[model samples]
Target chain A: MTEKELLKQLNKLRTINAEADFKAANRQMLLAQITQGEEVKSLGYLAQLNIFMSRLFQPYAIAIMIALFFVASGAYGLTISRQAKPGDSLYLAKKLSERTKMLVAFDEKTKARLNLEFASNRVLEMNLLKQDNNQSSAKETLKNDFKNEINQAKSRLAKNQPEAKSDKTNDFKTAGSVKDNDHIDVAVPDKKVATTTNQGAGIGEVLEEAQKLFDTGAYDQAADKLNEANKLVK
Target chain B: MTAKPQTDKSSNKSDRNIFLSLKKYQDKEAFMQAYDLYFDQIFRFIFFKIGNREDAQDLASATFLRCWGYVQEGKLKSEQEYKSLRSFLYKIARNLTIDYYRQARPQASLEEAEEIAADFNPGLIEAETSIEVEFITAKLKELKSEYRNILVLKYVNDLTISEIAPILGKTKGNVRVTLYRALEALKNLTRDHDGEGITKTIK
Candidate 1:
């Protein structure tokens, strides 16, 4: 083509719409890089202080300063830890930070999702802890924590839809079947057994029975039934 | 077309002012304004050169990042330290493009260019124009890198010889001559193609 006509055709080629997803991702990546770099630049003295104190206090002080530095960075460290995986030293910090975030979250839907995410993270943490040969008591404590979080999530969901309470009953039945197949004699407290037999069946039924037990001044049995219901629902 | 000269002069003046503001004060607002102003042009320039969206986005970002890096390093402390932000950015893009070609898998850029041409939908352009555009794009890849680059800067980017000289580190006279030679080479490369309309225009 003549240069003029060639230029005209070249202009047409420019109109091909760039893929939107790539554009958005690239923009975010670049903006994050730029902002992060600017943050570090603006906090140059803190970084210098970190180096200075680390030198003064020797090795242990470095860890202290690093913690202080993370706090000083104002949610940046928390943001970074959101992607932390198992075996990362920051993994527990990530979980704790997420819990703190959930506490401040105003929306019920968001809080529920965050609780579910925390529960998933706990499951991942449990697997990692097991791989590391952590004490059985520690593993049990994490299992309890996961179950509690899942119950909280379910409660929030049920608040949104009362019909979800029936879904919880089906979930509990599945849990009961799995426990039966394992044949592990899970130590049910005496109070829990009394309430479970009286409660009929399912998590919703047990919770309702526990409330009735609480009204009769049988607090121990009520607490036990609540705990049992939590495990069953999950 | 009659108002084009006045518009070009005003744009050139604006670029000069932005460059000065950035150089003298390291003004971030000014830098961002420049970025918003030139991002599309810079992206298109790289996209035209590389013929791939991902690489173009990367190299374009790299170009601006490098400029920001210079600012952080206080390299742009004076106007004399650099010519114009536009030229500086284009220079970075050109160098990065060359680096990409050096490290890139052999013939990958050409293959990508061909893929782009082949994938061109006729709805985007007149059917006849689409074929002509494809033919030119294919021929563009066959040209020597320097010739291909000059043609793109002049025709595709519509940069004047004077504006392009600093970016390419060539004299304006040299840019004009090189552009003419590049156009002639492109014409000769496409001579064998069944582009009667273009052949007549080129003749």
Candidate 2:
């Protein structure tokens, strides 16, 4: 073949491209690297954290993490303990799990809600003991534990009410000071007063009704009241 | 003598602008543009060097990554290193293929080249069922690396001698000479195999 023909033949190799899929994937990867590097350069720690969180929350990464957590935390034990009765072997585990949940609840309202939940659970155990014809002493002890939980829950919910009002009052005071100093419209707290007053009254009444039902030994009614209190708090 | 391919001046200017933006401002969009400009040619160059699709893909990726690294570092010895991103990428790809051979396996001798020629299939190019193309590619594998590279760069990638010179670390005159000789060698290879009907088909 002449060199012209040879050249023409060689030119056919142009059709031999990198696979389109590979080209696109590599482009995405390289561009991602470029952007990630620039982000780190410009945004520093926050960019690094963003990248870390994004990778951490990728589907496969999240799945692996959830699997690792379930394995390490012995979630099967927790699951079985959720069904344990007051005198069962896993009862302590159940209590420990409940305590752990409360400890990590991150806010007082959530903790109060947990207290109400555990109190309702204690009443259920007491009722179960009565159905099983357990000793009166055991039922009495469970009833006392239920009363303590309900009292703690009521006090917690009640404490949140005044704190909410006080916080609104402080916010209004700060807004007044800011308005006086800067002549700005610092009226943010004016919006919170009505909402807080309505919510505080609603939660206070629910907690009071729950307490009255408990005192009357209306356990089922108290459970329903506790739920209403929980909803109000939420 | 084989005439050099015409260089598109506007495209070259565009590539230079993108490279500068990446270097000066660390612009990601510019880097992506650079990637678009060079990925196919770089991938083809590395594919010619390594004779396999997968390793060629990896080395091609590495070539672009290393180029980005240099842009990020902003500490090259001279501005000539930044003169042509295309040449810079080719150099990186060539070095990566060399490293790949050194670390992964022995260099492909003439005998292994034959084995590669026989075993290699451009199966990924689904519509490319031409036997002549396959035969030419196999013959391309049989040539020395320098001759093969010069021919592929000159003819296949349509790079000008001046553009190829920096990539191969050779003078423009040297690239011209090598490209001529490479074309002659390919002609002889095809001529010798005329019984296989390449000559008949061309005629």
Best by lDDT: 2
Candidate 2 ranges with C-alpha deviation above 4 Å: A37-234, B76-83, B105-129, B192-203
Alpha carbon deviation, residue B198, candidate 2 (Å)? 3.2
Residue range A1-234, candidate 2, lDDT tens digits:
666667777888887778787775455445444444233233246643543364353434454344334333333343445566777755654554455345335456777889888987876766566576656776777668776776677677676777677878788887889888986788655757778877777766876787677767777888888788778778
After TM-score superposition, the amount by which residue A162's alpha carbon in candidate 1 deviates from its true location, in angstroms, is 67
Give the CAPRI class of candidate 1.
Answer: incorrect
List, residue by residue over B1-203, the lDDT tens digit for candidate 1: 11111124444555665676556555444455456556667776777666665556566767776777777687763444335677778887776666566443334574453333333222332343355566667777777666777776766665666668877778888987888788788767756544467645554
Q: Which pairs clash (backbone N, Cα, C closer than 3 Å) in model 2? A: none
C-alpha RMSD (angstroms) for model 2 = 26.8
Q: Residues A69-182, candidate 1: write the lDDT tens digits.
A: 533453354344445555554455454345434533545566666665665565555545655564667667665666676567657645644344555556566667767899
Candidate 1: segments with Cα more than 4 A from true spot? A1-3, A16-21, A37-234, B1-10, B77-83, B104-132, B190-203
Query: Which lDDT tens digits does candidate 2 get at residues B8-98?
Result: 6655766655555555566444456567667889888877776677667767777777777787798422436435667777877776666
